[model samples]
Target chain A: MTDDLPPLLLGRLNHVGIACPSIDDTIAMYARLFGATVSTPPFDLPAQGVRVAFIDVANSQLELIEPLGPDSPIHGFLKKNPAGGQHHVCFEVADIIAARDAMRARGATVLGSGEPRIGAHGVPIIFVHPRDTGGVLIELMATPDHY
Target chain B: MTDDLPPLLLGRLNHVGIACPSIDDTIAMYARLFGATVSTPPFDLPAQGVRVAFIDVANSQLELIEPLGPDSPIHGFLKKNPAGGQHHVCFEVADIIAARDAMRARGATVLGSGEPRIGAHGVPIIFVHPRDTGGVLIELMATPDHY
Candidate 1:
């Protein structure tokens, strides 16, 4: 059954999201240490309740997500540790809808299994529950340029 | 100043380490969805106080690490969240020594820079602190069979 599947949605890693208490400090640290360049500047996502900034570190990207308001996911994460930390890893998919469907067939649950929503980097994205992927919060993304 | 360095490290993602409460479930989830076969079976790392298994998921890998003893890193992480989750992401490099040196030059504190320790796949690896990489745990690795 598994052999018949097109492929696993474990696609290329788009970026690793870092939850930070202060996006400015986080950006500075990565810039100084890894010489990471800001590929995507800070932008707000009211729907997701956060602002994000991305720095390209060689092959992978380093993303800094900070909650704008108290209701944001970052807000909840910060309560545990103000420093905030690693958020979720994003994987580039050929088709997010198809990926979600494939994952469901394998006993995985997804937050949104239909159309992709605009996420950081102007890409269509969907979130898969961590419970379904070994408790690792996974984001499936499909960049228009790639598609 | 950022452009002075001769591309500090060779660019490619190595793997993402996931701390799972149930290695069996994690293994099944990945294998069923991604066609990810077990590249390395579960093995106990008494020194690190953890048991680990590895699977190659496309160009990258999915590693399942579980706590075997109380002193293990997995144990501490699991205590924080019993559900288990994404642990760390490793970056592949051509030369570990050169990469470590570059990181140090950039003010990054390496966990074990001088010596490269053998990982689950028998590859040499070193960990970089989250404090230095924008609050994201980073690992640098080199495998003889990789390049």
Candidate 2:
């Protein structure tokens, strides 16, 4: 049966990124609340100028991201408003290529073009800028299972 | 087969509430992108002094909320910041009654107790003030299905 549904653009939520003042504190809180354990400790994303850590949930994850240096984008965001809060929502897409094209046709801007890049859990991913998508930074990924 | 996984503390995502200067503009943009029409137009929430509308997705929604009066919370939020962006994420719980009790025991404050009210889809819901949830307003609901 060809489901004829608009093709479930997002497979499942890969992760949710939350901006944190300190990963130490956030990790501790998540551990207590959801029994999440630190899977990926703070690592720098030089390209994005931010550091991130992942607290593994059963299938999804909680990513805690902090700015690496003063010039980082996350730092600039923190400068304006320093309250530790949600940064973005990441979804696992069935096909990054098709999903990116579909979103672009719908007037959404794909941050990077070409082959999908690896993210948490070695999943191939792409990012959709907030400017084109109602002010929410959305990440699309293809999980390892699909790959 | 019984999957012993602890059921999601919250059901599927309820909505992503955005505090925009104009709900009409936000609603138009979302409609264009998601290919989903607004389930309802602006309705004033006098208790909060704001107007809200929702764009339904597969199992969740995107909410566009704007301040109705100048003294409203959203009005102040927009004035205080330039990049008035994604405001909050809401999740549906299994039982608002039990969830509220558990959250309170965990040191979280429940905003509107005893008002087990219906939301955009007539599902019972409640809100936990951001003040209690690390400065982010969180909504909890008891929807029928788990997303």
Candidate 3:
């Protein structure tokens, strides 16, 4: 809040996650309309509870995630947004645990076990509860160097 | 869709538009949690039917839109998501008219008057109907060069 204090994280938007019931159809739509292509096909991350594919853009990427099982994390989101929509937004952080601590200290709620988990990128990440964020899920991933 | 065909646009994600009932509260939350400092501050755009502010990140930006008048374009969205949410994703296109024609040729509906209009960044932009983009609102703006 002060002009003298620098931001806690780099604040780089790594990706925007989209909850897709069908990743293949989403891929086709993006390509046919925007010429946006996806190279790395969808891969299942059972631990993460979804199948994800990345669509590269000039700076950030669009992450397409499809429910993998009945207990998929995005199941509720899809139930509400049946046509699929932006699910969450990911940002790069300097220190996963420290950022987590700082946020918690400020009365922010970190989703899950309140600890870092290996994200689909194999980087440590944590989700900030949307209730504290005006109903938008926020993911903070450790910088690649930290990983 | 093919390796040979490059995207029609720069594929740069211009910004993710967020419909906010109160931009002030959203700005405060971002700064408190992510330390996302928005230096330029919020300003009104009567013609666009909303007040706007840009939060800069590492690569892309997040746009906060606060409806201005009774018929503000975002009134319907706020009624659905009072806490606010990501409304649309924008990408940079090399040729607005060409891209519009291309998508129309493919049967994707372009919203508005089907012509480029000046966006908040003072760039020419148009919205692609959500029905065509898997229920996600997509905005295609003329790349800086074309603008």
The residue ranges of model 2 lying beyond 4 angstroms of the native Cα positions read A1-14, A31-49, A53-61, A69-72, A92-94, A98-109, A112-116, A143-147, B1-11, B34-36, B39-48, B69-72, B81-84, B112-118, B121-124, B144-147
A1-147 per-residue lDDT for model 1 (tens digits): 354644555666777787988887776665565555567778888877898887765557767898888788778777866666767878888777788677777676777545567887677788888776666788888845842
Q: What is the interface RMSD of each candidate, in Å?
A: 3.5, 6.4, 2.2
The residue-level lDDT of candidate 2 at B46 comes to 69
The most accurate candidate by TM-score is: 3
Candidate 3, residues B9-48, lDDT tens digits: the string is 5468988899888999999888877778775589888877
How high is the lDDT of residue A30 in model 1?
58
Q: lDDT, candidate 3, residue A20?
A: 91
Model 1 chain B weakest 10-residue run by lDDT: B1-10
Highest lDDT: give the candidate number.
Answer: 3
State the interface C-alpha RMSD of candidate 2. Answer: 6.4
Name the best candidate (by DockQ): 3
- Candidate 1 residue pairs that clash: A8-B34
In candidate 2, what are the lDDT values of residues B50-127, reduced to their tens digit? 788876554456677888776776776777543456777677666788877766766667776547676645577777
Please provide, for model 1 over B21-112, each residue's C-alpha lDDT reduced to its tens digit, 9 standing for 90 to 100.
87877777766765566788888877666788887654566678988876777777787868887788887777878778888887778884
Candidate 2 lDDT over residue span A1-147, tens digit each: 123324446555566677877767666654443234577887877766678888654345567888777776677566655767767777766677888787888778888564567765566777888777656678877756832
What TM-score do all the candidates reach, one by one?
Answer: 0.82, 0.71, 0.94
